[model samples]
Target: MRDVCVIGLGLIGGSLLRAAAASGRTVWGATVSEVDADAASRGGYDVTTDAEAALQRAASADAIVVIAVPLPAVENLLRQVAQHASHCLLTDVVSVKGPMLDAVRRRAPYTRYVGGHPMAGTSRSGWLAGDTMLFRDAAWVVGVEEETDLTAWAEVTRLVLDVGAHAVPLPADSHDETVARISHLPHLFAAILASVGAQGGPLAMSLAAGSFRDGTRVAGSSPDLVRAMTEGNRDALLPIVDDALGRLGAARGSLASTGGLAATINAGHEGALALEATRDAARSGVRIDLTAADAREGLVALGERGGRITGLDGAVALGEVS
Candidate 1:
């Protein structure tokens, strides 16, 4: 197992550090948050607040570095990376991928990088919320761009699998667009639902049950974190937002003019059914030949069709698709 060095010891990073360590790999981490650093150190993990020092250590030991931080802080961290570990095998847990990929190109141009986003997390955050189990059974998207180093991509994919998540190879742009509709849009919906429900005052709040609580759950997440993710992916998110608004407009028009919501309700029901169908479908096994001429295309196509790499057998990718 390759040594792992994770930067940013919050929920995702701390959890990664723990998971990597548990998987029998040497692991260490750094964080800007003093509280998280102190807590992690007390928890018997090797952690520090010195980002450059940590990067330097990763450089010395040839550890795969995981950049786990907010979008706004990525550039600053990349600056340190440029100075200390510019050629390290790098990956990130940032939710948005396109901007991070672009940032790496502009800031740490020499680092062999792969962008990743684990399709897992909760409204709760911070070091204390770290859980080695958080990523189990999750679909972690690993970028496979034309310029992406296949070796680096494989290393990142292995790390994802080691942490108990299935690696879903994707292009950075495709990841941003796909997540805009699924992740970012849902956060916005949760916020909107919470806001709208709050307008009903105390009586509605008192009467709120499973539906209301579940719908507004993500609205409880930190506003700054939510803003950082959604706004950072604004370009990809805008069209999805427009589509959502259009559907909402149609629903409102139907309610006002015809006193019916069959179109919107039925569409939503079918969409939900499609989700279940996909989940319930039997998956077919596939082996991705990474040594082939069209390896990058194969990886991206597998992700496009919702396949996941369960593990790797040397350079080849062991995967399944529904």
Candidate 2:
């Protein structure tokens, strides 16, 4: 990426600014807050509150513009970027991809737009919460559409690598569906648990343990941000919520049956193990493909090929034997 401009210097945006500056690149940042602009300036980046001005300053065919704002602000910023810096490769760090992709496609039809979501950040907001190493080793989803320019995609992936993140290429729809299950659903569950516990009175709050605190940590996230994410992707999230409710109902039914609760707990434990194993395999740069008809044979074949079977998720098994 050549000259890169980050619009909205919140946690993700601030972190991006820090990373880009560290990489010795020409980086500019824009935020509405004077405090954030000062912070970005202090961090060795040219900062401004006027996003269009920043884009205009950094405008180039090789320049990259990263929109790091929340979902609600994405469309407008995209439109501004398209109007001000049409030649630059545009991307965003919004959590929900489907809507953002559609908006980009609509507003910036001529600009090369790559939808991005850095799988990083804490329950924190604004530039003050920024960590230079926040995205280190994190999975940064790069949404690859059919019309995505390969050169622009490479520029985005290069930026991902420059920021010490792994670029996981995924279709926008797939990215939304996957994050709905793994990200949005958990946030909703955390909010629900926190809300219920809060309503249980002071005694319940006092009696809460590490599990409760840790599990509901995300509930402390910015309410507006959470609302935007959940509401923006409600279509994808609803089905996951329904599936979760169905599973919960089954577990409740099992609690009244012989060994049902134990089986449920055991299943969860196995699932956690599998997830961890798959994570490790991914970290080790290993990929495994499995067939349901001969999963045993597949495992044997993997092992023979010097690949190790680490985990199984539904019909698929993954490992890093090599």
Clashing pairs in 1: none
RMSD of each: 0.7, 7.4
Q: How displaced is residue 173 in candidate 2, in Å?
A: 0.9
Model 2, position 151: C-alpha lDDT score = 53
* Candidate 1 per-residue C-alpha lDDT over 12-76 given as tens digits, one digit per residue, 9 for 90 to 100: 99999999998999999999999999999999999999999999999999999999999999999
Candidate 1 overall lDDT versus native: 0.93
Model 1 has how many clashing residue pairs?
Answer: 0
Clashing pairs in 2: 307-321, 308-321
Q: Best by lDDT, which number?
A: 1
TM-score list, all predictions: 0.99, 0.85
**lDDT tens digits, residues 18-59, model 2?**
897777788888998899998777866788999889888768
Query: What lDDT would each prediction earn against the true structure?
Result: 0.93, 0.79
